[model samples]
Target: MQQGPEGGSKHMYMEVSRQIGRMAAKGARVLEFRCVVSELYIALRTILIASVTSLRCRLQKRMLTKLLNALDAAAELSTTDRLDEVIHNMVEVGKSIGSNSSVEELLAQQNLLVRMLKKMNRLLEEEEACKASCALCSIEFLERIARYVPSSTVPIWKHMKASIINFLAWSDSRVSEHACWLVTTIIDGDWVKQWSENSLEKKKFWKNFFALLQADSLQAQRLLEEMFTFPGSVTLLFSVTDDFNVESTVAKHLCCAIRHKQLNNSNLFPLVSYFSEMVCVLKDNSENESFLCTLRRLVKAFCLATSDDQSPYFSVRNNFALTIGAVDLLRQIDELAKSGIEIYKRKRDFDNGINGGNVNPASGLKQCLVRLIANLTCEHHGNCDLARKLGAVPILLESTKLDCCNLFMTQWAIFALRSMMKEDSGCRDIISSMKPTSDVRLD
Candidate 1:
C-alpha cells in the first residue's frame, strides 16, 4: 500500500483491498470468508451510505402482503449505476450470515437471507418473475448457501425442491446444473433424515439425481457425474483433486452405457466433445491440471478396456470399428495441432502459465491423444494397419516440427508413431522415401 514511500496512496491501498476481496471469495476461500464478515459489512455499509445523496425513503408497512411487495420492489430501489457493487456487497454480508450470525446480529436482528430466499423462491415459482439467467444465478447462489450452511437450509431447500425438479429436465443445462449440485449438497448434509420413513418419497430424490446424470445434454451429464467425482461446486469444483470415492465412478458407468448404446451404435462420440471443450478453455493451474489429469485417466481407462484382448470390452472395439474409424480421431488430432499452430502464429509468442513457464495448456491434450492412440495400437495389428493407411506417418512427421506453443510435441508424436510403425510394414518405406533437407527444392 505504501507506494514509493508515500505511505498514504489511496490507489495502491484500494488495489490491495480489491485483490484481497477477490481472494476471499475464490473457491474454498469462502469457508474462511465469514471470519471477516463484521469488518466487511462495516466497510461496505459505510461506502453504501456515503454513496447515497439525499436518497431517502420511508416504509410504512400497512399489511403483510404490501410489506412483501415493498421488499420485492426494494430491489429496484437501488437504481444506482453501481447496482452490481451494491448487490455484491449485500450478498457478501448476507450470504455470510449462514457462517457468521454476527452479520444478522449487527443489523437490528433482521434476517435478510430469509427475505432473499423467499424472493428467490417466488422467482422460481412464477415464470414471469424470472429470466433464464436470473433463475440460473439464483440456483447457483443458493447452492453456495447450502454448501456453507449445510442442513440448516434444508427446510428452505425442500420448499424450493418442487420448483427445482421442474428445472432438472429442462433443455438448458445451465439451470439444472446447480440444481443438481444443490440436491447433492442436501444429500451430503443428510437432509433425508426427516423422510426416512417413507421409502418411495426418500427414493424420489435419487430418482431425480439419476435422471439428471442421464440427461440428454452431455454437459449436464458431465456436470452432475463430476459431482460424484468432485462433490460440491462451491469449493470442491474449483479445487479439482483425485482424492475421491471410486465406488461412485460415473465416468465408467457412462462409458459402459455408451457401449450398450453401441449395440445399436448410437451416440458413439464418447467424451471427445467434452474433452475438446476442456482443451479449448484449459489453463495452467493446479485446478485445471488435476481436472485434465482425471479426464486423461478416464479416457485411458476406456482405451485400455477396449484394446486388451482378454478384457470383455475388447469385443466392443471390433463391434464399433466402423463407427470408431469413421470418427477419424487421428485426423481430428491433426486438425487440433494445426489450430494450435495457427493460434501460435497469431499470438507470435507463448504466455506463461500460472506457475511461470513450467506449464503448457494444449500439451496435455496432445499427450492424452498420443497415449490414447498408442494404447489403442498396442498388440492390435489391425488397428496399426488402419492407422498407417490413414496417413498417420506424415501427420506424425509434421508434428515433429518445432511447435513452441505445444511443448513436447516431438516426444509425444514420436511415441505414438513408433507404436504405429512397430506393427505396420510401411513406416520404414515412408521414412526412406522422404528426401533430405539439402536435396529438397525450396520452390
Candidate 2:
C-alpha cells in the first residue's frame, strides 16, 4: 500500500515538472505567463497566415511576429471585456520586469498600459468593422477605463486619451458623435483633479486638443455642443473663436452654456472678446439679412448673460460707462442700424406715393437700438451715468432730424431721439436740438 502511494505521487510530480519545463523553454516568464501564452498564440497565427502569402524574408517575418504578439495580448483582454484584470496583469508584469527601480517600473508600467489599450482599440475596431454598436460598446468600456485614471491608473491616462482620440478619428459621423459624447463625459467629470495636477500637462493637453479641433471643424462643433451641457462646458465654449468655421449648432449651444452663472465667469474674457468680434461681423453692410437674424439670436444670448443683476458690468460708475467700455460693440450695433436705415431709404425711393409706403428702415433699426439700450441701461443704470458718459444723448439728437434729412434717415433719427427722450432729460435736450431750423442744412 505504501509503495503504491509513493509511486503515484512521484508520477504526478514528474508530469507537473515536465509541464513547467515546457513553459520555461517557450520563454514564458512566470510573472507574465498569461502575456507570454497570448504572445505565443499570436505568433503561431501570424506564421500560419504568412506561409500562404506571396511575401517573403526573415526581416518581414520578424516584424510581423512582434506585431502579432503585441496585438494578440491586446486582443485577449479586450475580447474578454475584462479591462481591470488586464490592467492588473500589465502592472504585475511591469513590476516583475523592472523590479530594480521604482522609476523604471513606473515607466514600464505606463508604456505597457498605453500599448495594450491602443492595441485593444485597434482589435475592436477591426473586429467590429467600426459598426455603431461596436463603437458604442467600446466607448462604454473606455469610460470604465477612464475611471481608473487618477490612481495606479494615472499611468494609463496617456493610453486612454489616445484610444478615445483615435476612436474619434476612425469612426464615421454617427460613431464619432458617440465617441465625442463619451470623451465629453470624462472631460466634464471629477477626473479634473487627476489630470489638472500638472499645469504643464494641462497646457499641453489643451494645446493639442485645440489643434485637433481646428483640424476638423465639424467634429469640433459636435464635440463643443456636447461639452456645452457639461458642468464646466462654458470654459470650452469661450476658448473657441468665431474664426473656427464653427457650425451654427455649436454657436447656439455655446450661447446656452454661458446663459448660466458659473459658466459666464469662467469664460468672461474669451467670451466677451469673441462676442465683440462677432457683433462687428454681424453689423457689417455686406452681411445678408438672414445672417443678421441669426446674429440677432446670438446677441440676444449675450444680452441675457450681461444683463443679469450680478453681471460683471453691475458695478460700473454710470449707465453709459458700460456702453462706452463696449464702444466697439456699440459701433457694430450702429453699423447694423445704419444698414437697416439704408435698406429702408432704397425701398422708399423706389416706391410711388403712399403715406407709410416709404416706412423707414430707420424705424426698424430704432427698435433694435431701443431694445439694446434698455437692456444695457436696466443692468447698469443704478451705478452708471449712461446717457452722459456714452454720449448717447447726442447720438439720439442726431437721429431725430427727419424733415431736412431723407425720409428714411430722418425716420431713424426721429426714432432714436424719441427713444432717448423716453430714457432721461439728457436725451430730451439731444432730441430738441434737431428741431426743424432754417439754418440746418438739407441736402
Candidate 3:
C-alpha cells in the first residue's frame, strides 16, 4: 500500500517529533544531556531538510514549537551539565529557524530572539562563563537572521549592542569570537544603511562605534584581526557614499590613534598585510575598476596611517618598503601603466569615431596607481631608486601625457616623476630630455 504525500509527511513529522520529544526528556538527565542535545540537533536538521514547504505547514510548525518549548523548559533547569546542553541545543534551533524562515516568520517569533538575548545577559551577569559562551553562540545564530531581516531586527540589535560590545572583551576566546562576528554583521549589514540615512545619525553612529573600539585596545585588536579574514572589510569600512560619512571619521581617528601611540604594531599589522594582498590582486585584475577603486581608498588609508611622525612604526619608509617590496610594487605599477595606455589608445580611437575596441578607458585606475607610487616614494629613498631601476620613469612620463583632460592623473604622474627624480640624476635627465612641453606642467 502506497502512502499519499500528506500521509507520508505526517508520518515523517510524527516520527521526528517523537524523537525530538524523547531527546528533550533525556536532556533532563545530567549524564545523558550532551548525547540528547546532539540527537535533538540531528532531528531538527532532518526536519529542516525534509521539505521547507512541509516544515512551514501546520504539523511541522507544531513540532517546531514543541521543540522550542522543550528547549526553553530545559534552559530553566540549572544542572551544570544539562544547562550547557540546553543552551547549545537552543542555539542550534535558532540557527535552523533563522536559516529557513522568512522575515515575517522571524518577526512573529521575536520573543525567541529576546529570550535568547536575555539568557545571554543573565548568564553573563551570573559570571557563568561556560553558559554565557553558549548563550553568545545562540546570539550569533540570531545575528544571521538579523542580516536578512534588518528592518525588523535593527531595533533589537541596537538595544543589544552594549551587551554585544561588552562580550567582545570577554576573557573567553570563543565568546569574544562570537561577539566579533555579531558586531561585524550588524555594522556591515543593511541595517546600518537604514540607520545612517540622516547625516547626523551617520556621524553619531560612527563616532560611538569607533569610540567603543578605542576604549578597549585588546578588543580592538581582536576585532581588526577578525575583519582581516574577509578581503573587503577594510574597503567597506573606509567607503563613502551619500548616506554614509564615516570614511573621513575613521581615517582621522586612525591617524590620531597612531600618533598618540594608542595602538601597537599588532593592531596595525593586519591592515598592512591585507594591503599587500590587495596590491597583488589589483596587479592581476587591473580590468576590475570597482576593485581598483576600493584598492585606492584602502591604499589612501594605509598612507594616512603611516604618514604620522609619531606613529609607533615611525620608519614608514622602510616599513612600507619591507612589507610591499619596492621591486614588486614597481613591476605592478608598470603592468597598470601598460593597461592604462591601451585604454587611452582605445578612448582616443573612439573619440575619432574609430571602433578600436569596446573597453572603457581606465584613466582613473592609472591615476590611482601613479598616486600610490607617489605616496610610496614621497620621502622613501629605496622606493625612489627602485622606481628608477624598474623602468617606472618612462611609465610616469607616459601617464602624464596620456590624459591631458584628466588633470588629476596628470598631477599625480608629475608628482611621482618628481619623487623618482629627487635623488636620481639619471631619472632627472630622462625627464629633461623628454622636454615635456610647457603645456605639460609638472607643478
* Leading candidate by TM-score: 2
Q: Measured by C-alpha RMSD in angstroms, how accurate is candidate 2?
A: 15.7
- Higher-TM-score candidate among 1 and 3? 3
Indicate which candidate wins on lDDT: 3
Give one digit per residue, the lDDT tens place, for model 3 in 157-216.
644664564565465656665665666655533443443345654554444445445445
Candidate 3 clashing pairs? none
Error of 3 at 9 (Å): 68
Model 1 over residues 1-443: C-alpha lDDT tens digits?
33332223334445556756786667436545564554455555555543331121111112223434543653445233323433443345434444543322323222444555565555455444344555565566556555554354444555456546655644456766667655655554133334333455334544554555544445445444434332122122212222322212444454554344321122223333444443444333223544544444445445545555665445544433532432254455456445664322312223456676525432344444555566566656776777677776676666556555555555667776787678777766777788756542221
The true-versus-predicted C-alpha distance at residue 327 of model 1, in Å, is: 8.4
- After superposition of all CA atoms, the RMSD between model 3 and the true structure is 19.2
- TM-scores of the candidates are 0.35, 0.50, 0.39
Better-scoring candidate (TM-score), 1 or 2: 2
Model 1 residue 15 lDDT score: 54
Estimate every model's Cα lDDT from 0 to 1. 0.47, 0.48, 0.55
lDDT of 2 by residue, 285-356 (tens): 333544443344444455556556666533322333335434344454555446675543322322333675
